[model samples]
Target: MSAIALRGPERVVIHQHRRALWSAGALALMGVAVVVAAWLWASSASDTFAGSGCSVENTVRGCGDTVRAFLDTELRFSRAVDYAGLAMMVLPACVGMFVAGPLVGRELESGTYQTSWSQSVSPARWLAARLAVPAVLTLAGVSVLSAFSAWAWSRAKGTYYPRGDWYEREVYGAMGTAPVGYALCVLALGALAGLLLRRTVAAMVVTVLAYVPLVMVLNRVREDLWPTARFLGGDRPGGDAWPVDSGMLTASGRAIRLKDCSGGAGDTAACMRDRGGVTAFADYHPASHFWPLQLVETGILLALAALAVALAFRVLRRRHG
Candidate 1:
């Protein structure tokens, strides 16, 4: 008897690709439209600044109320862009759930993977195909969106309005190579969860529940990943510093919260001195540290993603080998 021809994982890839084409295309169009709108808005804001002779370098100088109102309008619009960009930052988490749930979980739960296994497709190859296609697409799409977001943010941040800052959590997630790393990590996480749970609803729930804590931990630890600089005896060093911690140093060399000395007897400075405070200090990351922080965070997230992917393959091999 002749043996049946087996295309193995190719069939799985092709099937999934066809299913995702329209959704992926729609997402891509939406991303492009958002970026174009931000760029145009930024351009118009720039023209407003130029017309008023009020560059970021000289925003302090008097510009008429008309110019100020226009600039304020621009700031408000930039805040809207910020909201959209932040939503994009969480796109990976959404992708991760989809990957784990309907993509892999449903197949496993419904015993469809068995059909593929019955063919010449090894469990490992099937799982690999499941992970790779969506991963590639997610990486490409998220990276472009992150770059566009960063560009628009840079243009808007130069305004005199205080509506945004780099250290803001959502802004940080939206701005750099970090979002790419995040997307990859979540996709792997979703894949692993699906493989372990082997149930569509459970895997979907686990992915959603797990992603929030993971993001929170990352944010809490991010500023500490690199050594922060201590600024002493000054107002903040400059415009582009992220103040992580601030306090007054006691004469006995203990640090006390800045607020501890506020609203005390006599003047604030005198009150601080009486409380054994000798100097003020701030531990912070300067604007120059932006890329360093971003690269370090990206490295950490990608490492986590690699670990998740490795474990997922191991789990598949153990379960099916």
Candidate 2:
């Protein structure tokens, strides 16, 4: 009945840390809102530019910048998929590295895990409550944010697929399906790191500098090294198409509108400009294998995270014992 103790189902030990919960929730919302607003503003600018009176041949500054950013925002992405990738890939990773920023590290710092473990509640449950509540909220926020990103990018002329050039880096996938799993895993990692490191700052730093990078960078590096490998998902973006089958240059290429970005056919279409759509370009090229590729790759990563988290539980129990 004190600040450090709570009774609940052994499976889910949820303590009421209203302050931490509120803070996490607020931070998550703000992070996602920033992406949403950036996308919307970009989308609106793109739309306005798409419709504005400015002609490319005209001698006026006109909607040049507006049109560029607008088309850049959505072009070739869905709201959910876009946001999902960002949330899952970037946000959750950051938060997951930090979720334990308050959870395990703080407990160890205050030496509360010691007191709590002495109670009937096992070390597992203590970490569970601390991790579970925040993990759930963080994953939920990730899902919402990803959904919006996908929507915002749906109208993009060229989409997020990289055809050629350096612009293909923007087209990432949705965080909803895969990100939830990742977020949970990240929470677990946070707890494990916090417990092991016994310092929230160190845990956070390690999570970001070590674990998150390890997970995130592999795909990128593999894409660069053995792009044709199926397991690596290659440089073909998020889909499973053979690069030979793709008429475009490579996955590393920036996104380019096949048509004029202004909606007309001729020279100077947005597609011709060769802007990178999204990182790892997952959208565009209708009916291609990108959809399946995105789903499968996301599944693999999330599963890895799940496994990591499960292992962390064991480690927590061991340490607690």
Q: In terms of lDDT, which candidate is strongest? A: 1
| Candidate 2: tens digits of C-alpha lDDT, residues 1-321 | 222453462223334356655675686667556656655665565567657766545536666775455445554334433443445467656666666666667778878667667767777777667765666566667677656554544533344432221113344434235455556556667766777788878888776765556555644542333233221222544432333222222356644333324456654422433543332222233233444445665566666767767777877768656
Could you estimate the TM-score for every candidate?
0.81, 0.59
lDDT of each: 0.78, 0.54
Model 2 ranges off by over 4 Å: 1-17, 27-54, 59-89, 156-169, 173-176, 221-287
Q: Residue 192 lDDT in model 2?
A: 69
Per-structure clash totals for the candidates: 0, 43
Q: Over 4 Å off in model 1, which ranges?
A: 1-11, 41-76, 159-163, 250-275
